[model samples]
Target: MEERSNYVLRDNNDIGTVQIADDVVAMIASLAVRDIEGVEACAGNMAGELMDKVGIKNARKGAKIDIFENRVKVDVFVNIAYGYNIPVTCGKVQDKVKTTIENMTGLTVTDVNVRVVAVSMPNNK
Candidate 1:
């Protein structure tokens, strides 16, 4: 019997393999976005919300990844802070996400689409 995993290490002489999961990639994106200055929180989509209701916490809540055709496409949903610049913040996120994923996982990130789902203002109370 042969073993199976998600990752395929692209080295012929190396005697090792790495299996990376989609959720792991999503988590990486989530962490990368958190390092930015203007992000308030990760905003999960409809399916993510439904999963939360069922007592399941998806680590890739805000980050969605599709790996195919020798590349990966990631979509991140987030709520931004009111005082920060949206375009600048998103650009930083895009760059960070792409770089971090590629550097950490050795995968090619083709597209990183950031969606600002909400704007949250600081409470005055």
Candidate 2:
């Protein structure tokens, strides 16, 4: 991967620096979270799946990435299985996201915020 120059916004002044892109971090986090057990799905918006199918290759709409001086913050919207423990599952999601993003991008993960938007019951048709 090519290194992109980073920019800092300081009191309306632009400072050039080098950092990992937010999209790359988000995608790594999202995929890592999805790999954990008890996670029914990784996305909360329709556009997310559409983008995935269309080869957009990054988390959009429902995923937010905050870049900081020494760390990164990620927020993921998810749907959980009906019988899963909400707290446990969410915690696992947070852990996996943080570990993956940090390991892959070499950036410290300060926080991982998970929003459970819905629960999906098992289909018994």
Candidate 3:
């Protein structure tokens, strides 16, 4: 299997160029959303889901990262836990992801787009 070798380059004149993997930002976003109360899980697309089914776990599964001109745009896919306000929860997600990524990477986060893929209901006992 081949690996994706994508990186976000940050050049530091006094030191050296810093390379941040695209997957690293995605993983950061994934962890950021975990603390939200209404978040069920980071839900990836059909292909990612299929890969998960086969035990090919992806650290950056549900988050898509785009970098250009030293700025970033991220799309996060998630399943909301049942009985939470969608708007509020998504807003929280957006804020958390944007802030977390910017703080960690020192890059300007242009946008954090949240897509609610599903509403997870609890299984009856």
Candidate 4:
């Protein structure tokens, strides 16, 4: 696990505190994307891939999370397996990711932008 800075935010009241980090959000997003069918992979970029190789799961891989005044926005790159409807798969990923993040983190998801980076064909192993 890479060292992540604490992302704590004071609640509306002075009663308690809330803490969350960028990596946590990314992990949630990656797992959410994997849960949906027809998604081959998250298509992690060079840095994310390198992190994974070292066993330090970046979680954010193909995901970029931006926090703005407590509202979160995510952009995810995806690789869809051949034979699936591009639009349908993208929609599912978007819905799943948005709902998952909102429900799990209790943060307002401004958007979950799905970028279809590449298409991959199934392997005959």
Candidate 5:
């Protein structure tokens, strides 16, 4: 047996091994959220927000992904557009992220936790 760290091994055959990184999983979640209608933006965690202040931007800003024995858990912070139903938007985000990750990575997504950090005001100009 071999010891694995960040990446999860999806398959191993005579040719080679296929692995998916945690960062990659986070990126997938972020993208899935982006496509949802009412998502204003993906808000980063405290550390990631601090990094932004200093001119460093995290590519995968809002999504936090954890993998354990081929199972994945995701936490995504988001800003929703004003007047949109919060529960509906969050539910859409949850469903999309879970389906996308499972389809793409072949790993089971145990749960997707959505945190509504802020709501963007609709512009009337």
Candidate 6:
């Protein structure tokens, strides 16, 4: 009698091999925005903080990422420095997020939507 093996065969298909998770994209966007000069901080809700506690500091709650065909869309919420120009600062954040994600991840960032949730003003007497 011949002995039988219980091993299963594997498929070598490329269709399901390449992928990037939404959390990774969100983290990348968060880091990119943080690197900008005028950015005070990245805005996050309660859930975001919880994610950070689990070692996912860059995880964002309200941010959205849509991967379609060869393009990606990202939305980020941030708080800016009080004295900086809001429009200019937001533009910088948007450009950084788009360029960084596209260059690093090879994903075409079609849109970078930035929402200014708050402004941080310096304490003055």
Q: Which prediction has the highest TM-score against the true structure? A: 5
Q: What value of lDDT does candidate 5 attain over all alpha carbons?
A: 0.80
Prediction 1 TM-score vs. true: 0.78
Specify the poorest-scoring 10-residue window by lDDT in model 6.
Answer: 2-11
Report the C-alpha lDDT of model 6 over 4-109, residue by residue, as the tens digit. 2221122348643455666667778888877787787787765456655665434355355666765788878787878899999999988899999888777789
Candidate 1, residues 1-125: lDDT per residue as tens digits? Answer: 32322655364556755568777888899888886899987776654575457654442378877788548889887789998999999999999999999999889999999888778889782
Give the CA lDDT, 0 to 100, for residue 115 in model 2: 77
Worst 10 residues of 5 by lDDT: 1-10
lDDT of 4 by residue, 1-125 (tens): 34665565556565788888987888788779886789988866654465457654443377767777778888877889888999999999999999999898888899998878678887983
Best by lDDT: 3
RMSD of 6: 10.5
Better of 4 and 6 by TM-score: 4
Better of 1 and 5 by lDDT: 5
lDDT of 5 by residue, 68-109 (tens): 889998988788999899999999999999999999988999
lDDT of each: 0.78, 0.71, 0.81, 0.79, 0.80, 0.71
Q: Give the C-alpha miss distance for residue 121 in model 6, angstroms.
A: 1.7
RMSD of 2: 7.3
Preferred candidate (TM-score higher): 1 or 6: 1
What's each prediction's TM-score?
Answer: 0.78, 0.70, 0.80, 0.77, 0.81, 0.71
